[model samples]
Target: MNFKKKLSDILFLDIETIPQKEHWENLSSKEQELFTQKTLYQRKDEITAEDFYERAGIWAEFGKIICISVGFFTGLDENKMFRVKSFFGDDEHKILSDFKDLLESHFSKNQHVLCAHNGKEFDFPFIARRMIIHQIVLPKKLNLFGKKPWEVPHLDTLELWKFGDYKHYTSLKLLTHVLGVPSPKDDIDGSEVAKVYYQENNIERIVTYCEKDTIAVAQILLKMNNEKLLEDKNIIKV
Candidate 1:
């Protein structure tokens, strides 16, 4: 594959999430108890809708969106470069709404690929769910529903690393280390994002973390395409 052409059709994205607050308070006592129980277990498969709703509610209150960072890399000016843009939102609804619009406007019919690290399982679905909640239609090009697993056009860095073993699962940070991408040295792992966002109102910190992850994704893509991975210092802030 021509690296330049492929890069032109790629967009890298990442998001930051926090737990919901007011929604949790609205649940009845039994529902609240279920939520409390599920929180203790942290097992999605064993939970019921009531439990899920309560958890989603808890996430909704403190569940502010810290960032929706994206990178659009394309061939331009006879030079290969990537343009990075990020959307930061303290308001979850508005942030997700804006992200949908941004994606719809940029989406094209040229076989572009939406790239993310572990996006198929998490980030992509989260975005899709938020769009549904906001009554926003996803761009036609991004409709991954019901597609065969192999036929799905969206590329996941983590998925690619499996490399036919199908049993090894590695975090993006580990892949970054193997590929020589500098870790952003972020203090907060994703599990703590909700706590930090809600309890501390630390939106900026989360945004920074999201940006770092986006950069890491871009670097991984560079390695996949056999290109000299550019340092993320060159990434432009959106």
Candidate 2:
């Protein structure tokens, strides 16, 4: 399949999330009970709700986004570079608001598209949910209430790799490795994100990791189009 969208029209991004609270015990009695009910099926017969609490970051109701790193291609052909910027902090509202501002100010056009590895299932919906929680307006690219499927200005590298196969799932790391792109998981994996955020208190480290994933997504898109990956000097962090 041919890719019609121009590289410059795509904004590649990745997000890092952690459980709403550092520990299960920090939740109130009612909240704890609700969490127990929420995970009853997933935690059945083996683990208690508290034992499975660390996995809460995958759920929008129990999780909060701490970092969102975005990258965009600039220039043409061999002269292109990927410029990355990250919005992150302990304050979820501020982080989301900053990202929202970026979306509103620049990427709100109908021709622009937001792309991620598995954004449709994870990053996109997670951002929208957290935006609602923060009472921020959903940006045009993200607000999909009345838009048809083809009208949605969103792209997923994983979905593009799927072709017509719905049962297979390919991870960004695995795809990058197979496609001869740089691995973004050299420092840390998703499982360690919450620990790094809550225990290590290293927001910068998480931001760096998130930025790496954003770069990887951009590279994946380039590789899919039979284009060269960006050199180290061509990747700028802001």
Candidate 3:
């Protein structure tokens, strides 16, 4: 069963991350050894560790979050507007700290919950790990220290689609396409995020892409409840 929350109480979010350094050579000897050892089985025998380093961004320990975009609805029905804002830059610490403040200030309540696509496995844990690494305190919404699985204040669009099949996996792009939510991959996809950040050095483009995914998560939630999809005009980028 889909657990429904008031539209106004849910915060839809997405994050973009990149490898800590631009290239494999940028990592120290010890870090490279650690990376190779940990990823050996996952990379298989043919692909060298350096050749597989492009995937480092998917792991929080080897990567840093560059952007976090969030959207939430205000008002009801035809008057509803989704306000989106992004915290992004080359400074990972500042980005994490700023996101923590936003969570503590606006979304700090038992009634409030966070919703994201595949957030349970990826987005939520990645943010929490980066916050711990930076020595920033976790906000109520993100901190799962003593909370039971049922008590966690989070909603994952991917999890909802699973319907008790633990092995079922789906990408946000695929889910949105099948569920009739407007596709968020009009610009860049997740695989190209690292290249765009390191080679192209485009923070604005990343922020735009991240925000679109966040909006798509929101639209997916609405679709699950048989609500209308949001129009472009109703999506205000703050």
Q: What TM-score quantifies how close candidate 1 is to the native fold?
A: 0.79
Give the lDDT ranking, best first: 2, 3, 1
Per-model clash counts, in order, read 9, 0, 0
Candidate 3 residue-wise lDDT, 1-238, digit = tens: 3445789999999999988988999999999999999899898778999999999998888999999999999999899999999999988999889888888889998899998999999999999999999988889898898999999999999998898898999999999999988999999999999989888988899999999999999998888888889999999999
* Model 3 alpha-carbon drift over 4 Å, by segment: 1-3
The 0-to-1 C-alpha lDDT of every candidate, in the order given, reads 0.69, 0.92, 0.92
Task: Find the candidate with the highest lDDT and give its number.
Answer: 2
Worst 10 residues of 3 by lDDT: 1-10
Can you give the lDDT of residue 186 in candidate 2? Answer: 97
Screening candidate 3 with a backbone cut-off below 3 angstroms (N, C-alpha, C), the clashing residue pairs are none
> How accurate locally is residue 59 in candidate 1, as Cα lDDT from 0 to 100?
40
Q: What is the lDDT of residue 164 in candidate 1?
A: 68
Better candidate by lDDT, 1 or 3: 3
User: After aligning candidate 2 to the native by TM-score, how far in Å is the CA of 129 from where it should be?
Assistant: 0.4
Model 1, residue 194: C-alpha shift (Å): 2.0
Q: Model 3 residue 119 lDDT?
A: 96
Put down candidate 2 lDDT per residue, 26-111, tens digits, no spaces: 99999899999999999985999999999999988999999999999899988998999999998899999999899888888878
Off by over 4 Å in 2: none
